[model samples]
Target: MVPQLILVTAFTLYPIVMTHVYSLFEWPGFGPLDRFVGLRNYTRILADELFWNAFQKSFIFMAGTVALQLPLALLIAILLNSERLYGRNVYRTLFFIPVVTTSAVIGIVMRSIFASHDGLVNNGLQLLGLIDRPIRWLAQGDTAMIALILVASWKWLGIKMIMWLAGLQSLPVELYDAAKVDGASFWQTFRHITVPLLVPVGVVVLLFSMVDALTAFDLIFTMTEGGPGFATEFMELYIYRYAFTSFAGGLPQLGYASAAGVFFGVTVFLISLVLSLLARRASQVRR
Candidate 1:
């Protein structure tokens, strides 16, 4: 416990504290931290159109991934949880393979797969007479975001499925037996028994999925670098760009970036808090 506390303090709490402290200054990554413009960075971030655009994109990504991924993962998990399913373990392993794969590798591979010229998607679409010419999937703003969402949802689907599987497996076998004895149809049993029982786990899964979608950086960065005119630039990437990379041939704005980071962090925290409240209310109602 002492070692764990030490590690948490050193890695998490310290960084968070320092980030807040740095947000008051206008310092670059190095040199003096002399310029102290308290609250100015926060005000600037609020006024920045690019920052707002990135915020909107982040929410879009979050909404898209959660909408697409969770339902599909839940269905797959239910299927895999079935005792009658053949080679269920093999299927589980196959689904989970993508979850363990490196995000960078997935991003790079997906970029090639979605490329305009002779890419797998374009070629397949053309062969199926869906289109006569290759579509620039990553070269357009709207399509680029769609591609990011699809790839992100695919990559994280397995982990959510696994979470759902755990919840499903933990359900009381006696309730299922009674449902079977009472001649409840699959849909009826699922709706009345399974769905109610899964609320707690569903809350957890939803929280994780939302956070993952919001904080997604490595995959999007490696694949698109927020390119095609910043179409796919999410909040995390926006922070990274200001924190590390030089903008307009200027020095890295570490202080301003820290302010953005703090703002984003607060937004995520508020969302999580609301979700937790809803989860608590849900549990009380279930009781």
Candidate 2:
């Protein structure tokens, strides 16, 4: 147990410790660790307007995801939980295919599909006479954000559906029977029974989406790189740009990037803590 604990601590905490140490220095991430810059990197991050924009984008993504994603999952879960549904196993497997696929591949697919003027989405819209010309879905600001939100929701909804299905199934049957015996209507039973019982599942899904939004990198990286004028710029993508891009002294800002990463991590951590508290409060209120 002691040896296992030591390994776990080393594997997890070591990188974080190093990130903190590196953040205090002006290193290029490849060369020798340089002299301490004290809190310069952190201060720079604090002053960077781009960083704040990314942070705002992350929250927007979070709101869009939780608003649309989980309810869709729950609706599907309810449908899937119905005993009348045929071939439930087949439907479950089909939906979960996206969840099992490689995220990079998914990002690539999304990028292509949402391409401007020539992509499948635009082509379909043109066919439907929705627009005279191809709208640049990924190149525009509000629409680009909406595209990411939809893609993120689509890619993750299936897993949440399965989770909610499990939660629904685990719910004891007697509760429903009693509700029906009390002459409760379908809506009444659903409002009273289903909602109350599924609070835990909601909390879990909210936390999952929150962290995913906070640290979203691959999708945004592959999709936009926070581009078309930083409209869709997210925190993780912003850090990558700062650390790697050669935009005239942009590259080799390792200390600043690490500071940004630590700031993002701490921000997400505190948000998650607040959500945990909110979930607890909600559960208590329901009780």
Candidate 3:
């Protein structure tokens, strides 16, 4: 227990504390933390239009992924949960393959698939007579965002389905048996018995999905790199841009990036706290 505690402090707690401390300075990545700017970094971040844009994009991505993934994953889980379903395990493994695959690799492959000319999607659409001209999927702002959301959703869909499956399997067979005996139809059993019973687990899954969506970086970065005039730039990409890349022909602003990181971390913490409270209240109500 002591070793585990020491490791946590050394890795997780230490980095977080240093990040907060770095947020107060005007230091670049390599130099000494001589400049003491106090909360100026935070103030500048709050005032920056780009920062707000990134925040809005992040929020949209989180909402879109959660909205699109959860219900679909739940439905798939329910279907796969049925005992009569043949080759369900194979289907589950196929779905989960995307989850295990590297995000960067997936991003690169998906980018090619959605490329403007002679891409898989464009060729298919042309073959089906859907569009006379190829559409630049990642070159336009709206389409780029839509594509990012969809790819992100697809990448994470399997894990959420697995989580839902776990919750479904944990349900007592007795309630389902009684529902069958009472002549409750499939939809009725699902609505009355399954949905209500799965609320607690659903809350947990929702929280996980929210956090995952908020912190998504690798796939988006590899695919779009926040291009097309910052259309797909989320919070993580925003921080990376300031922290690593030279913005506006200037040096990388580590202090400002740290401030953004701290702010984003706090926002994520608050959201998690709210969801946890909701989960607790839900369980209480269930009892």
Clashes of each: 0, 0, 0
User: Which one wins on TM-score?
Assistant: 3
lDDT value, candidate 2, whole model = 0.85
Cα deviation of 282 in candidate 1 (Å)?
Answer: 2.8
Can you rank all candidates by TM-score, best first? 3, 1, 2
Clashes by residue pair, model 1? none
lDDT agreement of model 1 with the native: 0.93
Candidate 2: stretches off by over 4 Å? 1-7, 248-250, 277-287
The per-prediction CA RMSD against the true structure, in angstroms, equals 1.5, 2.1, 1.4
How well is each residue in 1-287 modelled by candidate 3, as lDDT tens digits?
99999999999999999999999999778868889999999999999999999999999989999999999999999999998999999999998998999999999999999999898989999999999999999999988888888999899999999999999999999999999999999999999999999999899999999999999999999999987889989999999999998984589999999999999999999999999999999989988
**Residue 202 miss distance in model 2 (angstroms):** 1.1
TM-score of each: 0.95, 0.91, 0.96
Worst 10 residues of 3 by lDDT: 245-254
**What local distance difference test score does each model get?**
0.93, 0.85, 0.94
Instruction: Tell me the TM-score of model 3.
Output: 0.96
Off by over 4 Å in 1: 1-6
Q: Give the Cα error of residue 79 in candidate 1, in Å.
A: 0.7
